[model samples]
Target: MSIKKNRLSQNGIYGPLTQKTLRNLLKKELITNFGFENMHIIADILIDRFLKIISECSVEKERIKPYQTIVFAVDRNQRFGYGKTMSQTKLIPVTVNIITHQELEELASGKYLKDLRPKIVTRILKEAYAQGGVLSLNDVAIICGVPNTIIKKAMRDYYKQHPDEILPHIGTIFDCGATMTHKRIIIKLYLSGLLTKEISEKTNHHPFNVDSYISSFEQVRGLYEEGKGVQQIAFFTGFSQSLVKEYIQIIKELNQLQNNNKPNGLMSLTS
Candidate 1:
């Protein structure tokens, strides 16, 4: 979104644009088997996580963290809408009164919520635009202050428009076959420090592919192995050939620098 054409504020519970981004995040997801009760609980949890992550930064770091509070109001008052009431009793989770999928669709399409601040709507619109109009529930929830369940509800509403393609599970965007899923599982297993040929056999993908996706760091160490070219290694691994080359070159340069025992000299790597 157009984010005020300036730098974001370094301090605040959430910036106005950040809040809107969070709302868009929630709106983009499919909300299956969810209601206000669950939405409120999730919102509270996400807001707390956002606050903790935001506190660690003096300004925007090279990496950005997601915050959700600025997007959806905890209540009509647009306040934190959480913590204990003055009476010291815990407040009920805020009601997300948009009860029907139709209403959420209208809001996401910019038909509703037109009268509210543009900041309340534009960020989601921008993100949806960026993603070529297909926003997954998991991706949006990662940005919003809502729980994955609420985001799933939003996504469900959107999926109602498309009945042909088989719907994907949460957090899975790849459109490969069952074999690909199995391959992914094996890759994860290996990354968790399990090094075994059995995983490769079970997944049915070549061992080189599994190694490429799961352990680039380790793969670089094995560059001296005969009959293993980085380009061929990258092709089956699902990583770009360029990245494979970069890692290989880095390994060679690192070894050369170490052998020379130079403290400070010109390095060969461009990036």
Candidate 2:
């Protein structure tokens, strides 16, 4: 049997004559079941509720396809029916074609949303560990198509499972906390007299990063003032000779400026 289809009106309004037409068809049954005063009230209530349900279903349907039809039936005696089975008694058949977003995703991917959630959680953990356990929850959520709250929960579960693998703190490329932590590690290694290559190997950080941490402070200047040569300073500080020479130059310039600011011999004699 061919199925009839109808699109729900956008404004959710039915013409006055439409209500009148339906009322006329079912007027005897409605009035017999509900008295005259309750009949109108019942009709209004049914119409309002039906409009809301259909409106929501229609929106979901539109998201999946421009137009879709869902087949259902409304039995006068049963109140509602599903499918096109003929009723023994009087009944109203309905065909509503609304597909939810979740349904669409399942159809396209051959997997239900619930089934895919575990995969997302696994991927988030994999990416987090791959990045040295230093990713933010939002970053993981964006990449894995999972919500931030879900990702956090997954991470908490993962940490419980593998507490030894958890990082002491979360870090990102844009934050200074990771940089300061790296600097502290490098300084500790440098003070232990580890060479640049040794510190880089131990920290799994680039040699250039280790050098930057060493040169960013006055430690190199103090070592140089203690009669440490360029090569000696580089060996102990994990910096290259060129970087050591640069720090030495800055120290010499500062000392020269200070000496020049001192009073001349004649001013000293007067004092």
Best by TM-score: 2
Q: Using alpha carbons, what is the TM-score of model 1? A: 0.21
Q: Per model, how many backbone clashes are there?
A: 15, 3
Candidate 2: the clashing residue pairs are 69-97, 70-96, 70-97
Write one digit per residue (lDDT tens) for candidate 2, span 101-196: 555667697876554454445554333334333334554565555677776576556545653232322231212232244454555566456888
User: Cα lDDT of model 2 overall?
Assistant: 0.49
How well is each residue in 1-271 modelled by candidate 1, as lDDT tens digits? 3455333434344565566765445433423324444476676566566655554322443333332212211111112113534254212221111123544566688874433212222244333423223223443455454566765555444434432222322122221222133333553355344565755444433455556445664554354244478767776565667666655654565556545764434332222
TM-scores, in order shown?
A: 0.21, 0.25
Question: lDDT, candidate 2, residue 197?
Answer: 90
Each prediction's Cα lDDT score?
0.41, 0.49
Q: Provide the lDDT at 84 for model 1.
A: 30
